[model samples]
Target chain A: MSNARRIIVINPNSTPEVTSAMRDALDDRFLCLDIPEGPATIVTDRDVAEAGPRVAALAAAQEAPLAVIVACFSDPGVAETRAAVPCPVIGIQEAGVAAALALAPRFGIIALSELPIARHRVRLERMGMLERLADEVGLSGVSAYAAGHDPAVYDELLAAGRRLIASGAGAIVLGCGGFGPRRAVLQAALGVPIVDPVLAAAGVALSVTGGQR
Target chain B: MSNARRIIVINPNSTPEVTSAMRDALDDRFLCLDIPEGPATIVTDRDVAEAGPRVAALAAAQEAPLAVIVACFSDPGVAETRAAVPCPVIGIQEAGVAAALALAPRFGIIALSELPIARHRVRLERMGMLERLADEVGLSGVSAYAAGHDPAVYDELLAAGRRLIASGAGAIVLGCGGFGPRRAVLQAALGVPIVDPVLAAAGVALSVTGGQR
Candidate 1:
């Protein structure tokens, strides 16, 4: 059992590499948890649907932390998790989008795959922020596991970022939790504010937790 | 001279009441500075324009703090202040809008007067978030300085909030710094999320300062 001040960051996927990368990107004080029962990567709506309940259950079972961060960019079961917990439950996707909006008028997303783009669109539409999206560009060959291990994916990310800028994005949002560590590098390469969803979630979680860990 | 980790929160208006309200709302760790040369309240474009250079000058004169928060909702001289300082300079309006967007899709403003509504519209348009606005409801007889002392303003705020919700706002943003203390109360009364611009600026400032202050 973690202390009451600990923040639980839940990565809703089975890939340990992705979870490890997220933990590295987050503040050292937080407790990072990954759902072992989830799919290796959430590439489709079916994967999201399947992972949702498991993530929510894990979130509900945790003793009260300062807050809970749903580390996946799709924000698996965030509303359900929030209803089950007394403390704040923030979705990385929501935090990222909010950060991007603060930095720029229009924001574009660099997504891991074509399937997640549709899911991202639905979330934005539900938030009534579809109009603020310049575009969402996906790299077809990327997966959360491969994104950490492969140097080639950076090139794909760069290319997608350029296309998003060309499409009129004033800022860029890395649309996957695995992209957290690459935020500073991508922002420098792209010459725009780049929001990493995991970090954004941590920022919001920390704010809600009264600036404590 | 303040310490390097100190954050300077500037209430551009000259009113001591509004400034005191802002200081109380902010984290105790910050150093709040009030611009005594400006008008009593910034209710119009003329007032914002008048206060801009004074606010910018005050911001420029500060020895580098961790960050600077322009506490006025109109965010007078934010761009100029950012250019003048090496550290981050955040505006309450931008922070409030971002926080509202993070919590909900469509956000409405409870503004002080009709004059600020037009200025707020311009800022929203510049951010390309005009479409995300459900509406900007104003309290005809209210001023920032008066809002704190008058218990009657709460009724007007409630009316404005209900109208904003009727107009399709999923969340409410308090467009004046003086309304900061009433956020939780208003949220409970309105049955929705309420974003207080001053606290929102503090949250963003803390995030930009790497959560140190």
Candidate 2:
């Protein structure tokens, strides 16, 4: 209840289910917004690039947001949104990566699918955190489109998690925002830290939520 | 309450007030331990190195700890404690740094004293996080010995916070666990994200706690 400041988590995909999942994971302070004009889901660099301005537009329209969390793993419009808004605009991938760093020396990320792997690499490079990354593995069949509603996705996540650990990852970061609630499950199964980006953003949100403007 | 796993926050310092401050900032899941054999305050690299094995010994003696948080800002014994403990051993400096990364591209640290600057640089280099730090400034006179008991320390912290911001820090990390309770005040005064090192470790604690061994 103390996380009672106004923070908007904009899911720049047309999936209401993803929005619902985010709402379930976050508290009342976080208003999860689903863009009707967005792509089915963001996966490839193309999807991420296309989703950028649409997300930025929606983010620009929000009234007095203390902070905005770009909830997509590909982080569409995160840079543009920050310029558009008066407050901080955080990306889930960056938040999850930071959470991973907090836990271990070498961390791995499990993405929804292999398509966004390139995008993540670029973001990691920009953040200067690429050196600490052990590796990033993607689920073979779990697309970002179905990630929100699929309980079956957990199996794929667990399998990828095993490979990440075997690859020398000390902690695992769930790169997709759709993997929000399954963080504990992965942590228990993998016996290492599992970072849920949405949840990770909450700590940053709590720190700066009143208003930086 | 979901951070229900047993996590021990070990303050490798002789000051009980610092331990008490940690307990207040954290929840019941975090059992704060004040080491009687440690230095009254850890500032210099000598203080950090000396406290290492002593904190490691205390950590080794604890039974069934899900994770151990080396709650000192200097993070004494963190490496040694990790080797001695079966579960995760997180240091507040690393956690605070990661929390800073979550909020912004570049961050700053406000330490208890200038003596720990060299030690922090060594640790930051080891973690591969030195580049992300905008700056690390220490309060002129505050010691870990009196940090826990001084409500008056807020003024000193605010002054340092301004300097860090001016030096291009996007967020301010309370480098000392002794600065845990004053996070909100600093955040408000500085108009930037304020990280409480003790609290930052909790999110990492939650992800990996309840037995990573």
Candidate 3:
């Protein structure tokens, strides 16, 4: 069973609390990997630069992967890692957006902070899906490190979810891997689908890996 | 049980055989309703225009619905229906594309003929996702009415699937409702995830409507 082909979801940030929260958030069906080399925290574009090569290198070194997920919403090294691996390399943001699109015509994003909001925009634009983003809000001062563990992040996310729905987002995406645990409770409050990016990527991975072929 | 909230998957075209096949292709969880007023078959842009308002009116009149699906590959009237409906209104083309994005970076679409191929391009262009399309191929002479019952349509689809894989499609989408039943079989032969547009839309509906909100 240990040798069974697995989907590896790499949490690129090196902060232990962040990694631990992400590991707990992900389903047991996937292998949650925390790299020893990326930036200790991804608070800015500079941190994303520091994390990309480490993620690419880490993913390239994996064995028997059915798929790999770049768990950061910024998707720092997903493109590079895709070419380096034989299996599908899914980015959390893209997977989440895809799922959100299925749930509703337009979607909103809940980013841990401003940097990832910009990152999400860039990636969506590149994928030609920026138009589908109804709106995006960032938790003020809540870094990815804090988002991973602090329950205090709840109220801010809920308030933002209301505003996003008011802005015409039929569904919302938890844009940080750290926000994965908050999806269900938030969706219940928001009364719309709340997509957890890591879980969304895992679902996509499972669809591809569920069968032997 | 009879009055349970349902997802309405409207086949949009009025041809009886087409409706029958789509009913067979859809999982029982959804209610597949073929319109009495759209074009007899959707082959050209004129048919799309004729089908659009009929789809909108039919969708608006539905009762106790969790979601509505515009099941035609051309997605006639999806935008109009979305505006008319209180719940999620899913179009098969957009849903299929979203599922394909989850499976891989680029996807190929299999259309029934030259006309639906054109409609697919226009819609993808409107969505700003035209760039992500690897390629699209159509069965040379098959019409939607014939496609629904004819098993002989298999070989052309298989040949097209091979070329699409060669053209760099990591996944292939069955772009018409009639193509839905062939999905699992063709996917086995092609070695990639084959997206059935109706089923893809259904998955999204379930995500949004699965729980009573």
- In order, the Cα lDDT scores of the candidates are 0.77, 0.78, 0.77
DockQ of 3: 0.25
Which tens-of-lDDT digit does each residue in A1-213 have in candidate 2?
444547889888887777887888766767889888777667667778888898889888988787888888877888788778877788888877887887778999998777778778988998888999999997775755455456788788888899999988988888877776677777778887777777777655654553111
How far does residue A162 in candidate 3 sit from its true spot (Å)?
4.1
Q: Give the TM-score of chain A, superposed on the true chain A, for all candidates in the order listed.
A: 0.95, 0.92, 0.93
Candidate 1: CAPRI quality band: acceptable
User: Which parts of model 2 are misplaced by more than 4 Å?
Assistant: A1-4, A148-152, A207-213, B1-4, B148-152, B207-213
How many pairs of residues in model 1 come into backbone collision? 0
Give the higher-lDDT candidate: 1 or 2: 2
Name the best candidate (by DockQ): 2
Better of 1 and 3 by DockQ: 1
Worst 10 residues of 1 chain A by lDDT: A204-213
Q: Per-residue lDDT for B83-163 in model 1, tens only? A: 787665778888788777765557899888776788899888876667789899888858787766677888888899999
Ranking according to lDDT, highest score first: 2, 3, 1
Candidates' chain B TM-scores in the order shown: 0.95, 0.92, 0.93
lDDT for B95 in candidate 2 is 83
Worst 10 residues of 1 chain B by lDDT: B204-213
Score residue A67 of candidate 3 by CA lDDT: 79
The parts of candidate 1 lying over 4 Å away from their true place are A1-8, A16-32, A59-68, A79-89, A145-169, A185-191, A205-213, B1-8, B16-32, B57-68, B79-89, B125-135, B145-169, B188-191, B205-213
